[model samples]
Target: MKTETQTTGEQKGFYKLSSLQRIGFGSGDLAQNLIYQTVSMYLLIFYTNVFGISATAAGIMFLVVRVIDVIWDPIVGAFVDKKNPKMGKYRSYLILGGIPLTGFAILCFWNGFSGSLLYAYITYVGLSMIYTLINVPYGALNASLTRDTDEVTKLTSTRMFMANMGGLAVGYGVPILVQYLSPNGKINSPESAQAWFITMTLYAIAGLLLLVFCYTQTKERVVMDVKETENVKVSDLWTAFKHNGPLRILAFFFITAFAMMAIGNAAGSYYMIYNVQAPEMLPYFMALGSLPAFIFMPLVPAIKRAIGKKQLFYVFLTIAILGMIMLYIISVIPALRSQVWLVLVAQFIKSTGIIVATGYMWALVPEVISYGEHATGKRISGIVNALTGIFYKAGMALGGVVPGLVLAYVGFDKDNTITQSAFAEQGILWLVVVIPAILLLVAMFIISKYELDDAVIDKINHEIESRHKN
Candidate 1:
């Protein structure tokens, strides 16, 4: 009689998951985005104007903290792979890491530190590291679910849709809530620190609750055999990176895609507050950034199937580029700058492309996992996710670094309350348009190198399952 690992295998790679299962799984991303998006979009502005930190200091802190992630991600990945905990290898962290992450996330915005940079560092670093603890394993969990490429695509669609819901909440809700909570009705006002704290507290708790919901819903299936598992080392990440071709392409794409999103997201508040001169309309303006995802994401699987993967990326990326260009022209032209309606239209166009392109990238993760397992008999999901996590964070680092550096370079004075100079406004425009557009161009080229189509990944999955049976 053969053992479960070697033969008589009941667990197959492709399992058709139900809609409820898909939605539950997708909620995890939503939970993350709710809190994380707030940080990405507003944290810098919060640091400078509200929390009384300089843009340069915030920039350096962002870079240094992510450098910590560079060191920390591998350790967490290796540890997670080596031990199979009670709740589940991946899902358990949803509770374990998430609780502290919630505490730190709430604390990061508290201003109780009273402008203490040390407190800022401690809380932000804690939040990021704990986030990685959950993020790396959570990413690997997707591959362990099913090998159906279409199902993965659909799952990614649902995931992106839910993630955007979080974005919508942050993008639209945060500023509105902050303004409502603040005594003077100004969100970024230094005296309104309590307002920021209160707003984030509500968002943070909601995120943790959603994480629990995700924990209850997800179940991992197509994982490696227990007997096959071994001691995962830091070097395994390097090995995965060196050997996996699809991983190489996807990692680079993540870098560029996230940089574009980060730079654009970081600039949204600045653009609305300074460049647009309609602080009241900031909510509407920011909301447009994620609003397009809801309408376009549900159609991704159909779109990918209809036009094919590469073409879908090509078309969407081009649309994003066009939207960026349109935005730039509108900003530079004095008459068009005053036209908020025109700016919003261009924002919708750009965001539509960005949402689809970035949202669909999650589906590629499982494909790369299949390719790696096909090439090397070891299904090292943790290592692969750690590698991707590193690159995407690097991309996010670029987003953080660029805006702060730009603000510093342009001599953005947090003291100036009324309006910024022409040069400052121009710098802000570059953040939203020129910088992100250039990143999107790189993203398109990087994705073009991804050769694993759905049929190819499906074949790889089948071969791997057959080998398990034998």
Candidate 2:
């Protein structure tokens, strides 16, 4: 019988993807991010301002939901890894999990309960869990598509490009659509929020359709050949963590970096509306955040080659931090408030740094998986994704928790109109600048710990290839 090593040689090359094949894989991310960014950017405001949940209550809910993810993510990961079905292991969940995820996403936007915290909890929790079921596998599926490093980099760039397209739609399009749907531009009334529900329902349905499209179009070319062990044991979780140094570093990086982005994006709506006094300008401001992806994303492979991944990361992260500081300086000065256009320009620069560096990190997951295989003979894509998922959820937890808590800390009153208290405005400023900046600095430190580079990974791949040859 021909062994796995011979197969690896045949699979190696940049010619793994046709242009159509790239688009198919990239579209899957476009689908997921449409739903994901909607939740990340708008859900908190939906809960706090529209659905009538208090900021503190919503903060607690955000923390609790992420705790649930810690338990749920691994179960889905292990299940996908161990059971190798004929329809392709991970792609199947894009449909299975996506259907429920779509429904819950719509329900989350509904204003029927009239300030009911209970309804928010049930629907939002279901949305979070179902998203995990789909997302963990989707992440694993990226590695399954090919073992070619350059091809995966190309795939990651395309995937992130598609994701930013979704981000553009959600960030720029959602607010405008919601306002247009509302009666007389009033968002405070229940009827106004009902418009939000309708808009999001359309988005959710579209998102699900895209998931099915991704499922139909994708194929898995390389997967671990393993005997089905017993159902995944919790003990094995510890084993995966104990021996896997690269996974640990990547996990920490995901937690801090994702948390920073999530918290910043979620809080942005409030900052624009309450602090900047320009709710109408929100979509444009948000578009600026994702729009730079077109400019910078195409350049990632070249950038990585010139500076190396770690150095490029450091450069971008520092620039992002400096941009935040500039924002804070501008916000506090009354003279600068008149220059809203200038503030937006600063935001664009900051976002340029964040969007490219963070988006490219998805490609690093395969590197960690390959590293694990080099050290131990196992290539468990699921367990690695599961671990990565935990940190992502943790980052999302902070993203969820921080804004609500910060709003509450500043004593934001939901029942007010036209103007907020000075304390509340101060809270909005902190959300916009200081908190995310601090998190980014922390992320820079965490990424510094990542030891794997192109040379190191290439050596590991050679060793792994030789072992399979024996």
Please report the candidate that would top TM-score against the real structure: 1
Q: In model 1, what are the clashing residue pairs, if there are any?
A: none
lDDT agreement of model 2 with the native: 0.83
Give the Å error, residue 75, model 2: 1.0
Q: Alpha carbon lDDT of residue 307, candidate 1? A: 99
Residue by residue across 1-470, what tens digits does model 1's lDDT show?
A: 01123224334666777899899988899899988899999998889888989998898889988899999988888777767787987889888988888898899899876677888889889999999998999898888777778888988999999999999999999999999999889877787789999999999999999999999999877776555566567788888889998899999999999888988899888898888888898888889889999899999999998999999999999999999999999988979989999999999999999999998998899888878888878777888898899999999899999999999999998877558988999999999999999899888888989899888887888888888778
True-structure lDDT of candidate 1: 0.87
Query: Which tens-of-lDDT digit does each residue in 54-117 have in candidate 2?
Result: 8899988999999999998888778888877776778988888888998999999898896898
Give the Cα lDDT of each candidate. Answer: 0.87, 0.83
TM-score of each: 0.97, 0.95
Residue 462 in model 1: lDDT: 84
- List where candidate 1 sits over 4 angstroms from the true fold: 1-11
Point out where model 2 deviates above 4 Å: 1-15, 187-189, 226-232
